[model samples]
Target: MKKIRNFCIIAHIDHGKSTLADRLLEFTKTVSQREMQAQLLDNMDLERERGITIKSHAIQMNYVYKGEEYILNLIDTPGHVDFSYEVSRSIAACEGALLLVDASQGTEAQTISNLYLAINHDLVIIPVLNKIDLPGAMPEEIKDEMVDLLGCDRGDIIPASGKEGIGIEDILNAIVERIPAPVGNPDGPLQALIFDSVFNSYRGIEVIFRVKNGSIRKGDKVKFMATGKEYIADEIGTLGLQQIPKQVVECGDVGYLISGIKVAKEVKVGDTFTHIDRPASEAIVGFSEVKPMVFAGIYPVDTSEFEELREAMEKLQLNDAALVWEPETSAALGFGFRCGFLGMLHMEIVQERLEREFDMTVITTVPSVQFRVLTTKEKLLNISAPSEMPEPNFIKYIEEPYINAQIITKSDYIGPILNLCMDKRGILKNQIYLTAERVELQFLIPLAEVVFDFFDKLKTISRGYASLDYELAGYQESDMVKLDVMLNGEAVDALSAIVHRSKSYEWGKKLCEKLRELIPRQMFEIAIQAAIGQKIIARETVKAMRKDVLAKCYGGDISRKRKLLEKQKKGKKRMRQVGSVEIPQEAFMAVLKIN
Candidate 1:
């Protein structure tokens, strides 16, 4: 099947990879125009809600250009840097990649990184300049940049608007001409890469793969090319979202398989699968392990939802292996899970999916970096969530993870962007002019310091013109402490925090104000204090209610009292109650919220 060509689309955020995938599905008549949904590959509700690809997706299309039916497997990868590991795994599944560069935006860092990964994989690279129909699309300029930077022909630019279905046929033609077809012994040992997988109650785990050689069929005994774990292929099919049972998945074909696999970890991404008859000696380790660079706690507002939260995480983790979670107990939150994720966006996506798909509400702790803590006694503890951090005095040395970032923007906005980066405790590494009007600034910044609201702050300061790219740097020893927040002598788990010594006053004062905004008038005065070590650095007062006496039950309506109590009870679930009134989650969140 060496004559078969396989490829996927790679692009930056908002560069229209999914938009183009939808158009291709329609253009090739794989899915009818009537059913064409914009960003259709974003099948998960979370992806649609967030407007980003959190996981990779593959769809096979049988197109007849002449009299011959050619099978085209289109792999769609996530564009964000957080999912960089995922992008490379998807790249490993195919023989070629379609590099989509925004016509107006030119080549950003990710375009460069992904292009480099594809090149390293030895895949045939076809550069497509997308969004050409929109204004500010400097197609020629972008094309020139691609040739100069990527070493591709100037005429290789397939200018197309995936939204408007322009130059699509040419894209398909390029796939046929430029990308070499899948080739190997179709009769040899079966080797396929598990690029992505999903779980179904009825089917267990459904794994997707690009057949590198030989064929896969139902009832065939297969082993994980990497783990050497064996399972009988109960069924082999194509993923049209659900399994479409097919007779055989020959080499060069992209299909989904069910091995009745119960555990998600065994059939890991980049793990190869082969028949036992001609099992490969070693499993392919084409993909890298996904490690969560950021950690937080996901506590259900109502503790009863803990199991449901775990279930939701299980389902979500099937698609996103990078999202990590485990059972954890907090004095304030009772039973909850400590979740580790790639970044802030990843954390948000998980929460959104849990809320939307599973219909559960969760309170998340402030984002924290995993610190390799060295205690005065030489103990090692990997601390992430603020509440889980060791006592300030016990920590002899603390090392925090940092990232090297590239910020590209207009020349006029460089100063403000640089200023904002420094404000986040960033160390400027270098600055260079990418073009006459644009500049790129490099910085080494602690991941935790910039996790929560940095992107929003960046957009606000740069007028949404700057594009930032970050890759993890080595960890460094830093002085840090967890600042506990107390409201009327009760510790708020959500308000507990990790902070720098010098910014305690500022952070605490700002947190006190934020707590005030979150805490409503109560029956008793609430004293909110932010303290580092043993000293209180900031305080706020929420005076006892003057009028909420509810002086009278008012009506003969007992229902009104019940409704009021029920609503108040629900809100109190997220808040700690003192005497007869309740506090809020913000009181906890405020410990970290700075002015």
Candidate 2:
């Protein structure tokens, strides 16, 4: 127990957290030179391609420091704001964290947010300045900021370049020396916290957990406190670069347990595991289930593949507990699953994974935040999709989720960025100057406003110099209405959007214009109109396709040409009266990209 060190790496995206993990793995020789890969901890292909960590990974290492063998358990965490919950869970499982900051970029929005989370978890933070090899490195300034933020001595801050393998030894020593060993009773009843879990078709549910008290063995009967399900531990092991079976995993040790549960839904993140014979009196506290904030309906391109989509989502939910979904039907898109996610990026990653990993073609509706609707009879309901919303007459007022957003950028671009926020209906909360050159602006904005193109617009205005972080601030009342798009005088519910009354006209007009460009022309004229209830706010006309009906009559009489023209005109008018427009899938997707 004295030789065990548990810690994790936390930083903003692209801040060398993954790289430092790789260096640590290399230094400890967890993987030989021939077996090592870049971003070793980021096992997902999407993570490697995007240069971001999407999942939290834990690996145990054997390190020798000053002729003493040390047992090091390192957990690498995602740096994106969407996975902040994952970060919190990872911190809860560790005793300390390596707060890695990019020496060139200094601290970012996510850096501050993650630091606060670690502080809340009561984890000892060891500040490390990374990427010192970059030409624009500012080590002294960053050290000063760390001292101010952490109130730690300047000598405690380790300066290293993760990419260049500088100061790797110093970091390893700091972890063993500064970070305290896990404190728990080995003689007490068994209690372990499930930080994460994954489903295996052959082995069933494999759970990764940190043993808090006593020990677990292969034959131990483990009970999940939340689910009250007991299963004989078929296997127990620790994670190196791969799973290595172990006879026993004692207190303060991180390891995997195969519980013989076949379904993914049986195991959940943040659940407590205890020995069935000597179960703890109470489950561990501070284990909160992840609640998804963003909602979108995902439908298979082929209706027949609905079952495959369902299976895919079930398998996905095994690893992603933050994801929530249920069967739903759409009048426009047929059967699909209305899924909830943490944020837009998380939603995108799941969609991409389904398409790429599951080999299924899917169509996703425009993302929406859950809305609280009050009916005329005072019935409260939660609306996850626009199609789920009741008619305007059936409801009283609707409340939309809002977020407390923080934007950090240079002072010169403050004007444009603030104007952009205002356009997104942002209400100013507070502003602070982090330094003479950098300003942090805080706002309370509707989650719907930021879910679309607000982040891209902020980047555009700030020339890619700004960073953003936000947290849910609960629901707020607004003059919001559902703006529906009508094609050939029929409402397309999939194209419907919720907009503020003040900007409904602009959004409707813009949506109409974008749809007109995306939707192909048909045999008959197509009228594309945007409506708020019965009132049409904007409209665009897609002219009918013209055919040379008279071209077939070469050198014909004037009467013949006139008759042909009249007949063609009459046919077009009839077609316009009875023909229903077929909206292409591209048009549905195009509306989502409309800003």
Candidate 3:
């Protein structure tokens, strides 16, 4: 490879990675008059809706700097910490990363995390200041911070305005000059590393990989190193969206080739692909595993749509590898998926996507942390969903998951933020203040504590001025129980959580009623009670179904009566069918609402 450059653009959620990608596409003339879109790589509606890049999109562009053509494999990686695993994996596919700091907002928590990730990988780090054209633009000051934090020379910092299309060529030159060209054997037997793979009904599986040591031709037999599965490459190509056929997706280049494989997980992200005769280096990943900290049960509000719910989850999991699911049987809710997510954001995104994309309504359980407990008979169990927990009396000891969180915010917010954290059973770790008003507070909080309402609480307390990032600290042996919510003497599976002993009563008072309001008015006065064995600490009432059951169902006309009955049935079916009462999705989401 003569002049190859592989790098990913990293920034905070709204610091303009996609905007920069759009300018690059326009600068290189990659899209003609008829092919232009504002954010070309952000092809998904959700990506544009959130104003954040969700997936790591890659595009190849040719830039001529002074007369030399350098191949720029530009990777736009997701910036949210919820997708940190994806960021790490995407960074692994590159030799360098462009650190995009918001000139106005300075360095965010995610910028620090991404910078640390790139440094940990020993990849060349190039700092660039983005959004310089904004009202609060402070490129020089931000550049100084970058020089101090990232150890970059003053002149090395590139001032850019992705919105204004300023300094695009300079960034291009810096990429070619600063980032080293990828090196790998191009003549050996075909071996490619799969960064991502997607399933298509027509194409079967579109495998995205960086060819490392060999060239893969169309119809070549290749084996996935991790799974020892081999398949014939139906077609070899690179994706700038549409397929470019007959192109050799060689070393230092990112491309998507097709294989007649249907299982999505078989050729997982970070798996290595090579010819059956001789494969490339075995697959290696920077991250050991993707651990989903937040787990919930997703059930259909209309119980008859069980198949629709399953299909919705399957389609949702295709684009999100962090999402894990399997059929979960709940005595109260029948059958549903025990879905796992990286965090609350990941969970919400999945639920919203299922509703918006699949057009299916679902009732989601309050998110919970995994627990480890032992029965009196000495049988150890790992409990994910609340239904998996052992009977209350038969349990000996329980260790619930915990995460150490660090919040960085202005000094003005310390009092309120600390109060919010402490109320959630956060053990005050320590606090340190920097030169400016910025402060960092560390807390050891139960994973179940901050698992659901943490972010929203922070936003409300600080008026959206604080930034938080947390990783799983560890699981400690403690008194953990599956607090169950009983509606009219019957347990509702979606209202359970792994709560600590001390805070159960308080959380139950707030959460049980929350679940009641979430459950619509039922036929009879339903008592929503959170109980531990025979003890009930908190209670609420789901008032008798009064507003519903329209009088029109009894109209004298036979045909009109039939239509009225059908409509009433349709509306009632939207509510939960716990024993008998229907539960609407709006009611399901209301349980999780912080307000």
Best by TM-score: 2
lDDT top scorer: 2
Model 3 global lDDT (CA atoms, 0 to 1): 0.78
- Give the lDDT of residue 88 in candidate 3: 82
Q: Alpha-carbon error at 351 in model 3, in Å?
A: 1.8
Error of 3 at 158 (Å): 0.6
**Global fold similarity of model 1 (TM-score):** 0.90
Worst 10 residues of 2 by lDDT: 282-291
lDDT per residue for candidate 3 within 545-594, as digits (tens), equals: 54434464554667776666676666544543444656555655665673
Score every model by TM-score: 0.90, 0.96, 0.90
Task: Provide the overall lDDT of each model, using Cα atoms, as 2-decimal numbers.
Answer: 0.80, 0.89, 0.78
lDDT against true structure, model 2? 0.89
Summarize candidate 2's per-residue lDDT along 1-595 as a digit string, tens digits.
7888999999988899889999999999898999898999888889989988888999999999889999999999999888888898899899999999999887889899999999988899999999999999989988887888789999999999889999999999999999999998999999899998877778887899999889998899989998888899889999999899999998999999987787667787888999988998887664566878788889999999999999889888877777899999988889999999988889889999998889999998988888999999999998888877788999899999899999988899999988988888899899898878878899999998998778778889899889999988999878889999999888988889887899899989998999899888999899999998899999999999999887678795799999988998999999988988877778777766876
Q: Please, what are the lDDT tens digits per residue for candidate 1 over residues 146-224?
A: 8877787888878899888899999998898788888766887888878888888887998888887788988889888
- Compared to the true structure, candidate 2 yields what TM-score? 0.96
